[model samples]
Target: MNDYAIEVRGLTKRYGQRTAVEELSFVVPRGSIVGLLGPNGAGKSTTLRAIVGLLRPSSGDSLIDGVPFSALDNPASHVGVHMDGFGFEAGISARRHLEICRLAAGAPRSRVDEVLEEVGLAADARRRVKTFSTGMAQRLGLATALVGSPRTLVLDEPANGLDPDGIRWLRRFLRAFAERGGTVLLSSHQLAELEQVVDEVVVIKQRALFAGRLGDLVTSDADSLEGKYFDLVGGASA
Candidate 1:
């Protein structure tokens, strides 16, 4: 198997006359959590969308475990992606939503309860999704992603609307996931939250700019990863 869980070579995306991502290239090593950072309109989301086959790339290509993403019969088994909301039916119970996703992903029914417990949602399994707070919903989304036990995870702004305790759980969960030999690629506007979890980071400013280890990116002069991020991305905040 390839050492890289994901590889993008000279990737580009265009919408009409505007270019979203231009000639982007990066590699996400297996069993590592990589943070994708950039300001608003920096094409972070577009790059992820292309990788997960949501939006076709305008140029170049991406692969998951050396297999082209498009060639996979069921890409979700290899890559679990959570973008935006959890997409659960409000009236449905949390457990029911998990069952539906389990069936759709062809995942084993036995994994459903395991994932729910992993995400700390076991106590609320019978609660309707409509009553879930934003943090609860986010945890539910994470549980769904874990149901298939994918080799790679792609999450966009997962920390949004989460409280401090929830963020702590998320960081711990992601760290544990990576330590177990799974690759995680996450994008978030909250650099502080990411600093606690990611092993490496890929920063794009209008396009690809910096890609390296988290420690190297956040040197003593930089003091913090977010500070380095601002400097690298032209001091622009999303």
Candidate 2:
């Protein structure tokens, strides 16, 4: 088995004249939660999409457990992914949506209910996707990711619409997952909350500015994630 759950090596992507990312490299260890931090337009989303095979890199490559994402025998069984801007059919029930995903992933039908319960969506299982609030929808997305029983997860803004309790629940859930040998990579603007959960941090702005254990960024004063982030990336937004 590989020592790292994810490895992005000199990954680069370009769109005509625009460089989305350039020479970005990082590794996510097994059974650890790493926060991918960057300002807006930092190419965080692009890097993630390229790593998961949603977008091909113009140069370099990414691997999940030592194999390219496209080469995985059963991708969902190895890595779960949730990106924003994805929406379900307005009339589709959450349960039905999960069932469809489960089948497509070649997962057992029983996993649908298990993931629903795991994500706190069991009570809303029959609710139509359009009827769900942002928080509920986020939960549904997580359920979709979990149904495959993956060993790793890659999530973009998983806490966007969650309430305080929901955020706390997610923190606990991730900790428990990692304790059980599951790896997680999450990208979020919520620095304070991120500081509480992540074991490592990867900061970028088009390219990798910093990547190391969280403790490395925290100085003698115990700088906060937000403070250290701004300090490293500077006051600029992009």
Candidate 3:
């Protein structure tokens, strides 16, 4: 088994003449939650897309448990991913949508109910995706990812539409997941909210800026994560 759950070696992505990500590299250790922080267009999303095989890297590579994402025989079983724009058929019920994804991922049908309940969407299981509030939809998206019971989770702003209680629930859930040997990589613009959950921090300013334990970024009198964030990526722009 590899020491890290995720490893990116010089990963880069380019769009026409613009470079979205430039030789970015990082590692997510097994059983730890790491936050990917960056200003707008700092290449956080680009790097994540490359890692999950949503977009191919122009150069370099990323590996999940020592193997490239594309090489996984059952990818969902190894890594569950949720990007900012996860889409669901508006006409389908949440339960049906998860049922479909569960089948596609080769996960047992029983997992559909388990994940739905786990994400606090069981009561809305029969509701059409279009009828769900933003918070409910976010929960559904997380349910879809959880259906596979993946060892590693890669989520982009998973707390976007959640209420305070929901956010607290998510924090506890992720902490428990990591304690059970699951790995997590989360990216969010909510620095204060992020401070409650992540164990490590990976900050980027159109490039790799800092990567280390969250404690390292918190100096005396600068304990707030938001303060450390601005200090690290000041003047960064899209």
Q: Among all windows of ten consecutive residues in candidate 1, which has the lowest summed lDDT?
A: 229-238
Pairs of residues at least 3 apart in sequence or in different chains that clash in candidate 3: none
lDDT of 1 by residue, 1-238 (tens): 8789999899998889988888899999999999999888899988888898888888988888887878877776898888874488999999999999899888888988999999899999999999999889888888888777788999998887789998998999899889999999999989887888899999996567888799887877538988888788875432
Worst 10 residues of 2 by lDDT: 218-227
Q: Which ten residues in a row have the lowest lDDT in candidate 3?
A: 229-238
> Cα lDDT of all candidates, in order?
0.87, 0.92, 0.89
Among all candidates shown, the one with the greatest lDDT:
2
Candidate 2, residue 84: how far the Cα is off, in Å: 1.2
Candidate with better lDDT, 1 vs 2: 2
With candidate 2 superimposed using the best TM-score fit, by how many Å does residue 61's alpha carbon deviate from the native? 0.6
Clashing pairs in 2: none
Each prediction's TM-score against the native?
0.94, 0.97, 0.96
Residue 204 displacement in candidate 3 (angstroms): 0.8
- Spell out the clash pairs found in candidate 1: none
**Which segments of model 2 are wrong by more than 4 Å?**
235-238
Could you give the candidate ranking by TM-score, starting with the highest?
A: 2, 3, 1
lDDT of 3 by residue, 60-110 (tens): 999998999999989999999888877999999999999999999999989
Give candidates' CA RMSD values in order.
Answer: 1.9, 1.3, 1.4
